[model samples]
Target: MNNIKKSQLFWASCLALLVTSLSFGIRAGILGKLGTDFQLTATELGTITATAFWGFPLAVVIGGFIVDAIGMKRLLVMAFIFHLLGIVLTIFAQGYWTLFISTLLIGIANGTVEAACNPLVATIYPDNKTTKLNHFHLWFPGGIFLGTLIVILFNSIGLSWQIQVAIMIVPTLVYGYLFSKLDFPVTERVASGVSTATMYKSVTSPLFIFMFICMFGTAITELFTGQWIDVLLKNVTDNAILILTLTTGVMVIGRGLAEPIVHRFSPQGVLLISAILAALGLYLLSTLTGNAIYFAAFIFGLGVCYFWPTMLGFVAENIPKSGALGLNLMGGAGMFAVSVYTIFMGGFYDRLILKKLPAGANEADYLSAAPGTEMANLLNEAKNAAGPEVLQATLVIPIILVVAFTGLVIYMKNKKKEALTH
Candidate 1:
C-alpha cells in the first residue's frame, strides 16, 4: 500500500471516468444532428445508439474476467487507444454504418474504464465502500453537465458538432498520460486473498442474481431516458438539452452529498425511495409542460443520481468474495438491457408517430413534403403528439422498479435480522 500513490491514482481514475462520460454526453447532444444530416429514421438512429450500449457490456464483461490477470494499467491502455480511434472515426463518419462502428469503439473504451476503476476504488477505500464509490461516481453526472454545456455553447455560436466531439481528445490524452506514469495496486480480490474459485461461486448466490436482474430496470430507467431526452422532450420543452443539463447538474450535487444520506437511509432504503421519485418524475415529465418540466427533471435527476454507484457499492460491500467479476457483471447487465431497450423505444416512438398520421399519409409523404406545406405541418403535429406519449410509455419501467425495490428493502431487513439472531 505504501508503494502506491493513493491520491494520484484515485484522481486519475476520476479523470478516466470523466472521459467516458464525456463521450455519452457529447453523443447524446449530437444525435439529432446526425439523424437530420444522414436522412435517418428514428429506428436507424436508435440502432446506431444501441451499438454503444451493447459494445459497452462486451468490453466490461470481458475486461472483468481478465482485469486481475492483465492488471488495470493494460486495460486503460486499451481504453486510450480505442478512445482516439473512436473519436477520429466519428468525426469522419459518413452514414449509419460508420457511426455505429465509431460509437461501438467509444462504448468499448467507456466500459473498459469502468472495469478498471470500480475495482480500483474499492481496493483503495475498503473502509467506506458505498460513500466513497458515490463520491467517485459523481464525475459521471459532473462530466455530463460539462458535455451538455459544451454542446449548448458550441451550438449557440454556430460551431459544428464535429468540433464538439473533438474536444474529448484533450481529456483522453490527459488521462492516458496520467495512467502511464502511475503505479497501480492489486485488485481488492487479490489484496484480500480471496480465491478465484470462491469469487466465481459467490456471484451465483441468490442475492447477486436478484440484483443483476434489478440492474436492468435501474439502468434503462436512467440511461435510456437520458440518451433520448433531446428527441423525446423536444416538443414538450423549449430546450430539451437544457433539461438534460439541469438533471445532470442536480445529480452531481446529490452524489456529492451521498455519505450522510446513505447513513440515514441505508443503500436499500435509498434505492426504494429513488424508485418512487423516479416514477413520479417520469410521470410528471409526461404530463407537465413549459417551465414545470424543469421541476420534473430535478426530481428525476435526484432519483437516479445514486443508483449506479450505490448498486456497485452494495455488491462490493456485501459480496466481497464475488470481487471484480460481480461488480463488472452488474454493470454489464445494466448496459446490455439499455442497449436492447434503446432500439425498442426508438421503434415504439416511430410507431406512435406513424399511428398518429392521417390515414392516407405515409412516412414518405411527410419526409418529402416541402417546408410550410400541409403535410409537413401534419408531421410536426404528429411528432408533438407522440413525444409525450413516448415518455408515458416509459413510466412502466420505474413503476415496476418501485415494487421491486420495496421487496429488496424487506428482504435485506430479514437478512439483517437473521444475521443478528445467529
Candidate 2:
C-alpha cells in the first residue's frame, strides 16, 4: 500500500466510525426525551431502539457478503446516503413508527460502516490485525465520549436535541470528503485468490462456529448493558451522563492501550479476562451505593472494550480463509443478539412495574409524582422499582460467557501445543 493511500484510508475509516459512534451517543442521550415527546411506553421505546439493531444485522450480513464483490468504495457511498436519510428522517420523527424506521435506517448505516471498515482495516494491516483492529475500535468509545460530552454541553446551554443530532453531520461530511477520491484495496480474501466456496467452508468449520456462538454472548454483555445505562443509573446516581461518559472514556483508554495487552494475553486470553471482569462489574452495578459503582463502570468498560475488535481480530488472524464473510457473520450475530435483548429487557422492565412493586404502590401516584409525560413517568417509576432485579437477571449472561470462554481458552491452548509439536 502506498503511504498516502494508507493514511487516507485509516483516517477516513476513523471518521466513519466516529459518525456511527456519535449517532449511538446521541441516541442514548435522547432516549428518554424521545419517550417523553412521543408518550411512549418503555416497550414501545425499546422497539424503536431495537430498530437500529434490526437494520444492522440485515445490512451488515448482506454488506459483508457483497463488499468484496462490489468494492468498499461503493459501500462507503451507500453508508453516507443511508446516514443522511436516517438522520433527516429522525430529526422530523413524530411517532413511534417514524422513529423506528428512521433509527432502523441509521442502524443499517452503522452496520455498513462496520462491514466495510473491519475488512478495510484488516486488509490494510494484515500482519498486525489484532493491534490495529483494537486501534480502530478506540473510536467507538472516543466518539461516544465526544457525543456524550456534546450532549451534556448542549443541554447545559439549553440547545435543542435536533441540534445535537445535527452535530453528527460534521463527521459524516469529513469522512465522505476523505473517502471521495481515494482508491480502494480489494478484501484480503479476494486479494489472496481464496474462492468464495472456501470462505463459506471456513465459516462452517468447528472453530469458526464456536467463535460465532461466543460472539452473541459477548455482544449482549457489552451492548445490552450499555443500552440500560441511562435508565438503570438514574436510580443509582444523579450523574448518569458523567457515568456514561466515564465508562466510555475508560473504554477509549483501554482500547488505546490494547497493543501490549493483546501481545501479553493473546486474543483468547484477553476474552477470558474480559469475561471475568464484565461479570464482576455487572454484579457491582446491581448494588445501590458507594464509589464501587464508579469502579464497576470502569471495570465494565475495560471488560467490554476489546471484545468486538478482538473477536474480529481472532478470526482475521486464526481463520484467515473465512475472509469478509466470517467478519460479517460475526458482526451480524452480535447485532442480532443485541436487538433481541433490547426488546426482551424493555419488556422485563415494563413487567416489573406490576410484578415487583410494593403492594398498592399506587400507579397513579407514581405517575403523577415522577417527571415528564405519563409514559415517561411510568417508565421511570418502573426502572426505579426494578433496576436492581433487572441487573441481577443480566448477570447470567456474563457467567455463561466466563464458563464458555474458559473451555475455549483451554482448548485453544492444547491446540497450540499440538501444532508446535507437529
Candidate 3:
C-alpha cells in the first residue's frame, strides 16, 4: 500500500474511462453523419453501434478472468493499444465493416479499462468501496458531457467527425503515461486472501445471479437510450444531442454527490428509487413534446446516474468474496444485453417507420426522394412518429426494473434483519 501511488493510479483510471466515454459520446454525435456519408440504414447503423457493446463484454469477461494473473498495468497497456488502433481505424473507416471493427476495438479498450480500474479502486480504498467507486465513476458522464460539448462546438464550427474523434487521443496518451508511472496494488480479493474457488462460488450464488439478471434491464434503460438519443429524440426535439448532454451533465452532478446520497438511502434503496424515476422519465419523453423534453432528460439522468457504479459497489461490499470477476461479469452481462437489444431496437425502429409509410412505399423510395419533396416530407413525418414510439416501447425495461429493484430492496432488508438476529 505504501509503495502504490493510489491517487495517481485512480485519476489515471478516470482518464482512461474518460477516453472510453468520449468514444461513446462522440459516436453518438456522429451516427447521423456516418449514416448519410455511408448511405446506411437504421439497421446497419445499429449493427455498427452494437459492435461496441458486444465487444465490451468479450474483453471485460476475459479480462476479469485474467486481470489478477496478468496485472492491472498490462491491461491498461492493452486498452491504450486498442484505443489508438481503434481511433485511427475509425478516422479512416470507409464503410460498415471498417466501422464495426474499429468500434469493436474501442469497445474492447473501454472494457479493459473497467476490468483493471474497478478492482483497482476497490483494493485501494477498502473501507469506502461504494462511495469512492461512485466518485471514480463520475468521470463517465463527466467525459460524456465534455464529449458532447466538443461535438456541439466542432459541429458549429463545421469540423469533421474525424477531428472530433481525434480529440480522444489527447486523454488516451495522458492516461497511458500516468498508468505507466504508477505502481498498482493487488486486487481486494488477492489482498484479503480470498481463494479463487471461493470467488467463483460467490459469483454463482443466487444473489449474484439475481443482480446479473437485473443488470440487463438497468443497463439498457440507461445506455441504450443514451446512445440512441440523437436518433430517438431527433423528431421530438430540435436538438436531441442537447438532451444527451443535459442528461450526462445531470449524471456528473449526481455521481459527484453520490457519497451523501448513498449514505442516506443505501445503494439498494437508491437503485429502487432510480428505477422508478427512470421509468417515469422515459414515459414522459415518449409522450411529451417541445421544451418538456429537457425536463424528462433531467429526470432520466438522475435515475441512471448512480446505476452503474452503485451496482458495482453493492456487489463489492455485500459480495466481497466475488472479487473482480463479479464486477466484470456484471458489467459484461449488461453490455452483452445492450448489444442484443441495440440490434432489436434498430430493426424495430425501421419496421415502425416502414409501417407508417403509405401503401407500396418503401425505404428506397424515401431515400431516393429529393429533400423537401412530398415523399421526403412523408418520410420525415414517419421518422418523427416512429422515433418516439421506440422510446415508448423501451419504457417497459425500467418499468420491469421498478418491480425487480423492489424485490431486491425487500430481499436485502430481510438479509440484514437475519444477520442482526443471528
Candidate 4:
C-alpha cells in the first residue's frame, strides 16, 4: 500500500477501535448499574443484553447489503445513529420494555460499526490480513480499557449510568466524521459475480458450516465474560469503581499480551488452549470466591484474549470471497448465539437460584455481587437452586461441544490434504 493509503488505514483502524472500545469498555458496568437502579431480575438482565446482540443477527444482513449499495461512508454514519438513539432512549428508559428497545438500537449500532469497518480494514490491509486484523482489533480491548477508566471517572464523580452511556457519543461522532473523508471497499458479494443463491451454496458447504460453528463459540465465550465481569465483582465489593478497575485492568493485561502469544501458538492452537482454560475458569469463577474467583477471571481472560481475532482471521483466510459481508455475517451469527445463551443463563439464574437464595435478599444484587460462602444462606440457596454442574455447562458450551467439532474439522482437513499430496 502507498503512504497515503497506509495513513488512511491507520486512522480508519483507530476509528473502528475507538467505537468498539466505547461499546465493550462500559457495557458490563452499564448492565450492573441498570440492575442496581431498576431492581432487574437476572432474566431481565439477560433480555437487556439480548437486545444488543439481537441487532447483530439482522444488522449484518442489513449492513452487508447496504454498505455495498450506499457505500461505507453513509453506512458508517448511519451506524452512529443507533448509538445516539440508544443512549438517548437509555437515559429515558424507566421500564424493562423501554430498556430492551433502546438496547436493541445500541446493538444494531455495534453491529454496523463492525460490519462497515471489518470490510474497510480488509480492503486497507489486504496483504497481511491476519496481522492487520489483529492490530486493527487491538482497539476493541484497548477501548475496553478506556471504557473502564471512564466508568471509574463517572462513578467516582457520582454520575448516572445514563450519562456514562452518553459518553459513547464522543467516539460515535468522531468516527462518523472521520469515515466521511475516506472511501471503503465494496462487499465481495456485490463485487463477485455470485448471486445470493450461489453465495448461499458456497457458504452452506462443509467449510462454511464449520466456520459458523467456530464463530458461535468465539462470540459467546468472549461476550459472556465482557458482559459479566462487573456482575462478578459486584457480588463481593460495593465499591463498583474499584471492582471495574481491577477486573478490567487484569483483562487488559491478558489482551495486551495476545499479539506475542498468538505468534507462538498460531490462532487455532491458541484458541484450543484458551478454550480449555476458559471452561475451567468459568466453572471456577462461578463456584469459588475471594481470591479464587478473581484468579479464575484472570485465567478466563487469558484464554479469551485470542478468541475474537483468531476467529476473524480464520474466516478471512478460509473464505476469500466473503470480504466484509462474510466476517460481519459470522460475527452477527456469533452474537445471535450470545443472545440465546444469555436468555438461558438468565432463566437459570432467576428460576433456580434466585428463588431459593434467602428472603429479602435481592437476587439481582446477589448475582451482580457474587458473594462467597460466608453468606451461608445465599450460598445454600445457590447450592440448592443450582450446583457447580449448571455453571460448568454454560462455560463449556464452546469448548466441550463447539471446540470439539472444530478440532475434528481441522484434523480431518489436514489429513485429507496430506493424503492428496502423498
Q: Per-residue lDDT tens digits of candidate 2, residues 309-401?
A: 999999999999999989999999999999999999888877787565456665445544546766546546667768778878998988998
Taking all chains together, the TM-score of candidate 3 against the true structure is 0.98
Cα lDDT tens digits, model 4, 255-348, are 5566677677665666678677767777666677555666766676666666776677766766656556667778788888988988887777
Worst 10 residues of 2 by lDDT: 362-371
Model 4 CA lDDT for position 36? 57
RMSD of 4: 4.4
Q: Residue 395 of candidate 2: its Cα lDDT?
A: 89
TM-score (C-alpha, index-matched) for candidate 4: 0.84
In Å, residue 2's CA in model 4 sits off its true spot by 2.8
Cα lDDT tens digits for candidate 3, 148-201: 899999999999999999999999999988888877787889878999999999
Give the runs in model 2 whose Cα sits over 4 Å from its true position: 356-381
Provide C-alpha RMSD values for all models, in order. Answer: 1.3, 2.2, 1.2, 4.4
> Can you list the residue pairs that collide in candidate 1?
none
Per-residue alpha-carbon lDDT of candidate 1 for residues 361-406, written as tens digits (9 for 90 to 100)? 6776686677799988888788788888988888998889889889
lDDT at position 47, candidate 1: 94
Task: Estimate the overall C-alpha local distance difference test score of candidate 2.
Answer: 0.86
Model 4: lowest-lDDT 10 consecutive positions = 236-245
Q: Which one is best on lDDT? A: 3
The numbered model that scores best in TM-score is 3
User: In model 4, where do residues sit more than 4 Å from their true spots?
Assistant: 187-198, 236-263, 358-390, 401-422
**Clashes by residue pair, model 4:** 21-143, 234-369, 235-368, 235-369, 235-370
The model with the greater TM-score, 2 or 4, is 2
